[model samples]
Structure formats: structure tokens, C-alpha cells
Target chain A: MTDRRGTDERLAAWLDGAMNPADAAAFEAEMAGNPALAEQAAAWRANDRQIADALAPLATEPIDPEWLAQMGLAESTAVAPAMPPAANDNPAWWQKRWVPVGGALAAGLALVLLVVGRPPEDPQDGGLSLALDSTPALQQAQLDDGRMIEPVLTARAADGRWCREYRIGDVAGLACREPQGWKVEAEVEAAPATKPDEIQLAGGTDNTGIAAANARLGTADPLGAADEAALIASKWGDR
Target chain B: MADPGPDSQAMREEIIAVLPRLRRFCRGLTGHAENGDDLMQSTVERALGRAELFEAGTRVDAWMFRIARNLHIDAIRSVGRRGTQVDIDEIAETRGEDGRETVENRSDLAAAQRALQALPEEQRSAFLLVVVEGLSYREAAEVLEVPVGTIMSRLARARARIDAVVGRSQGTGND
Candidate 1:
């Protein structure tokens, strides 16, 4: 094979877009005349696509605490309030990276405390308790009698067995994957995030932060503290 | 640049936008699902931490990729005397030409990935930054702290070497 006039690497370089418009134009002309170089470029791009496809399949997956801990982004003592961002803000690719990955990663933490057991005798430590999986990247989760209770998400209501969401605020919502997908077994308004076990829906205060009741749970209204134990038995199917 | 806060935010945005592409680059570099995510995580962490270091309106993706390349290099060097070997079956396990699980003429893909890993760091870096990452010659030179001309020649040699290796796999490359 006759060696091309320019280096093989130069063509590779051109593909990366390192050249000036003038140089790029020149390179294009060279490519126009050299079918071999064109073919090589095509193959390189295909390889790139294949490699990329193999990577980052979990963009939509919640940013787990495990990943954050690996990066050293330890949670800060002072949780900064969400003030308005800069005026000339242009949305960045990296920041938006979170959206396609799963726009609802941090689903609103809507919580409701249920005592399905005889109501806790002591009003103080006495109800279904909820807490976020302190694990980094854990959108939010709860602890129920030492069991990890998470919101369930699923393609079908019966499948709603395991997905969970957390409301960071009225507008912000986040969800996390449950091994069993998500379920809306029994209708329960998630309690306030701060008070996991003893949450009672505040009367008429904006319910924006409330976790919307899933239609499949089939309960007309929210569940009472009396029904917790039996609700956990159902299963949800994944799409 | 005392926190070109606007620029910082902009850089972050730009980097996030190219995440899929960055992910693609990481996959090519790592050749495995877990390794790719780890590499990407490392690169993204570095980019976020060093976002201030990036010049206003600079090539954010290129900057992030440089970090990825360095991490991969450091990993290879750390393994010392032993390099990461990609399974030829992985290429087939991945996608195929006819969309089948068959290796589909990819005896060369694994060989290519291994050959890429085996190159002298400089040559490999130059080659991948250009070929796999799609960086321009000058841009790659900038990222590697080398001259443009050096990048061009290195790339030339890299391709020739890869061609020889792949050709051997295909039993067609003129050695």
C-alpha cells in the first residue's frame, strides 16, 4: 500500500478536531482524495461508539453515596440553601448529565409514619420511622423496625413492591431503585422527611411535599397507623 | 481568575453535557463495564475539583479526557509489569455487525484494545487521544504537554503499529 503523504496520526488528529479551520479544510480535501484515510476514520468513530455504548449504562441510576464517598464529596455540616443561580447561566453538559440519567433521582421525600402495630404506647418514640440511606447517592430511604424501607417504582402497580422517592422540597423529587422495583401496595402519604416515624399530615399546609399516593395501592385515602405489617407482603412486577 | 464563578458553572455544565461522550471514551479506555464507570467517576471527580483550573471557554471535554487518560495510565503503571488484558470474547459479548452475540470478525477488537494498552505510554496516549477520543493533533499535543508535530508522528507510528497487529489477527496486515 502506498503510504499517504500526511502521517496516519494526523488523520486521527483531524478526527479529534485539533486543527484550525484552514488546516481542517485542508485535511478534508486530503480525505476527499484518500479513500483509505476516510475508511480508517470511519472505523475509528465506530469503535468509539461501541466503547461508549459499553460504558455508563447507569446514567439514570441514582448517584449512590458509595460513589460520592469514593470521590471524597463528603456531606457538609452546612446544607446550603438553594438560592437562585447566576443570571447568565448557560446549562452545562456535565450538570445536565444528571437529567437523562434520571430526572427524578432526588424524588421529593414524602413521608407518613404508620404504627400498624398497637399505636406506640409512648407517643415520643412511637411510630413507623423513616430515614434516608445515609449512603452517598442514596436519593432517600427509610428504616422500618431495622429493615431498610425504600420507596418502590415499577412498570405496574403490582410491581410497585420496592421503588421509593424522597422530596427534598416542594418542587424537587428524587427516586432510588429497590431490588424489587417499586410498589404502591397500600396508600400511605409519606411523613415529613425530618420526622420519619412520627409524621402526621399537617392539616391544609401545602401538601406539595407529600408523596403522591400511587393509584395501584387501590386505597381511596391514606393508610392508618394500624395497617403497616400486612402491606409489606405484596409483590410488584418489572417492565 | 478568582473563581470565575460564572465560568466555573459554565464549565460544569459543559462537562455534564458531554457526559455520554465522556462515558464512551472511558468505555473504550477501560474495556469493561465496572472499570469504565470507575474511570469516568475518577475523571469527573477530578474535573469538578479542578473546574476552577480550567480556562474560561476552554475545551472542557478535552480537559476531562486528559484526566481520564492520566488515570488509566497511572493504573497501568501501578500494575507494573502486568497490564490489563481484554478478553476477545468481550467484543463479541458486546455488539456485533449483524446484531448477534457472535464475535463477528472482532478477533481484531480485543487485539486492538490490548495492543493499545501495550504501547509506550506516550505513543498510546497520543494515539488514543487522537483516534479514540477524537482530539485534534494540536489539541492532543496540548493535553499531553507535547508539541503538535510530535503528536502527528506518534499518531502515524501508532496507527501503523496497530494496523500491523490487527492485520496479523486478520491475517492480512502487511507486517
Candidate 2:
């Protein structure tokens, strides 16, 4: 250790396999001469292994699902639009896949409405129907009774259920879609000025449902409107 | 207002798949399970909010890693903690190693974690990026926005301290 200048550096470089051949040879010679240095280097290697072994289990730990879902939404948004196909090239195969999926989904939605009862109106109005316009896809969900309902926010629960915060003419309630039908989970007075549905799909503080969903579903984002509609339609028709 | 185009579904699935690695990296840095998770959540939220900034055809792992590191830094600063980002003293106090037993009777791993927690935030970031995450020195340097030499220096110091701590714990530090 005394003979070799930069002994720790030599040992660390050797342990990490960053040493050049000449330096590595010199390091080995120094180690062979000083058994103590050799032992210390071995100890360092063991330490590295220990650190890795201890932390490796962390890889198996579940990431917060809400965060995981949020990541999915974010990454998708990050991707740039596809360049137009080359003059000689045909459209992408995936582009074709969505067409049938879209049509089938819309058809499914209509079919599901036949057996499904209409969503109960706002409790505040004693059953007065809300003047709800069909917004974009992700925020708006169709009920069984030929009525279009918009949830303030929608999310997937950890139990694999789809949950939504719905407002019917100033009355807000939380319901989750089940195999049977929309099961009302909880209900509360509508919070003013907060459209949990339209808060950019990722998140915000105003949406406690988003927070609750984060806890329940791990923050996974709802599918885009078209995708969700198609899925609902398919599931409804299947039932 | 971008419709989830053709690639969106695939991209979403890909991000979902990478969650474990992201969690691991976060845990490695914060050295605290809860804080690390909070950091992971914040990073993903930030990334999703700024998804349009991610360059297509680039390594998403690197991008996310960078995001996590930056968010951690921001979190530290927001708390008005100057100098070291993580509280070394706090880590030492709560160093029960997540209240779990050692990995396969290897107590050295626990010792290594304590040592890791003791390191300065910057050095720990550099060391973990290289050793745990398996990033190259040059690549880690880029992620930390520091010179390669700085990364090398930080890593060397970190390894030496960890070795000393692990050795001392095992009663074989001084041969």
C-alpha cells in the first residue's frame, strides 16, 4: 500500500474493471507483494456486491401505479406526430387497426344502452336532467339509458375497475363500472369551478378523485376518449 | 390537443413497462423508500406534463432518469435545504433498512445502504448511476451535468467510503 501511489484509486479502478492493462498489471504486482492491500481490494469488491444485493430487491417493489399510468400518458404525449408516409409507402398497419376498433366501439356503446338503465339525475334537482353536451371522448361516458354523461374525472382502480366522478346538473357523484353496471360508490356536493374531467388527464390538486384514484388505481390515466368509447362499446355488446 | 395518434398506445405501454427500473433508480438515490417513491411520482407527473419535450428515437430511460434527478434536486431546494440535498442525519436515524431482514443473510448489503445514505447527495447520484443503474462513466457525467473527471472522482470517493463502512461493520476494515 505504501509502495503503490494512488493505491485506493488503483484498487477501485481494478474493482470496476476500468484499469488499463499496464496499470492493471502493476496493480496486481503491488497486490501480490502486499497481501493486506489484496484483502482490502477484495473487501471493496464484496462491498459493491453487498450494495447491489441489498438494493436489487427494490427492483421488485411495485412502482406507484398512478405514477406508472401517468408516465404512460406523458410518454405518449411526448412522441411527435408521425411523418406522412413516403410516396411509395402505404399507411402504417396500426393506423388501419384503429378504424375497426373505433367502429366496433361505437356500435358497442349503442347496444349497451338498451339494457342499461339511465343514470340517476342530480340529487339536488329531485331528478332534473342535467344539460350536458357530449364533450370530447375521454371525459364523456355514455350510460345505458341513451344519455351522455361526463365525469369530472375518470380513472382505473387497482382492482381493475374503471371509476369516474360524474356531475349531473350540479350534483356530483362517484361511480365505478362493474361487470353488472355502473355502481355508485360515493356521492358529494359538486365542488365549484373544478372540472375534474378536463384537467389535462395527468392530474391536479382540485381533483380529489384523481388523488383518490391515485390511491386506488395508482394514478393510471384513463384511455383517450375514442379508445375508451370503443372499449365500452365492445364490452357492452359483449355483455 | 394532440389526439393519441397511432404510436401513443405503444408508447404508453412502453412507459408502463419501464416503471420498475424508474422505481429502482429513485430508491437508489433517495435511500428512503417513501421519499424515493414520492420523487418517482413527481418525476412521472412532470414528465407526463412535459411529454412533448421528449425527443423521439432517443433513450427514454436516460430522459426519465434525468427528470428524476432534476426533480429530486428541485424538491431539496424547495424545502430550503442548502448544501446537501438529502438529510444524512435523518437517513442514519431511520436506517433500519426499510424494516426488512437482510438479503439472504447478507448483512453487508444493509451496511452498504447505510454507507450509501451517508454519502453526499451528488456523489451518491454519480455512484448509483454508474454502479447500480449500470450507466457508463461518460453517460453518468452527462446525466449529472458534471465533467467526467468529477464523476470519476465522486465514484472513487464513494466506493472508498462504502468499502470502509462495510468493512468496519463486518469487523474486517483494517487488515
Supply every candidate's count of residue pairs whose N, Cα or C atoms clash at under 3 angstroms.
61, 11
* DockQ of all models, two decimals each: 0.15, 0.20
lDDT of 1 at A72: 42
Candidate 1 local lDDT, A1-239, one digit each (tens): 23563646567557556666998898889888989878887765554454323332323233344544454432321124343322222111111222222223133323232211122122222111223212222233322111123322222123333323332322222232244222112222322233223222232222222223333232233223223222332221223
Clashes of 2: 11
**Candidate 2 local lDDT, A1-239, one digit each (tens):** 54343666667667766777998898899889999998888777777777777777666443443443444553432223223222222211111112222122211211001111235434322111221222333254332221235555555767777666555422345556654446555443322322224222221122232233345445366567666566556653345
By summed lDDT, which 10 consecutive residues of candidate 1 chain B come out lowest? B95-104
Instruction: Tell me each candidate's i-RMS in Å.
Output: 10.0, 10.4
Candidate 1 local lDDT, residue B78 = 56
Candidate with the greatest TM-score versus the true structure: 2
User: What TM-score number comes out for model 1?
Assistant: 0.42
At residue B153, give the lDDT of candidate 1. Answer: 71
lDDT of each: 0.46, 0.56
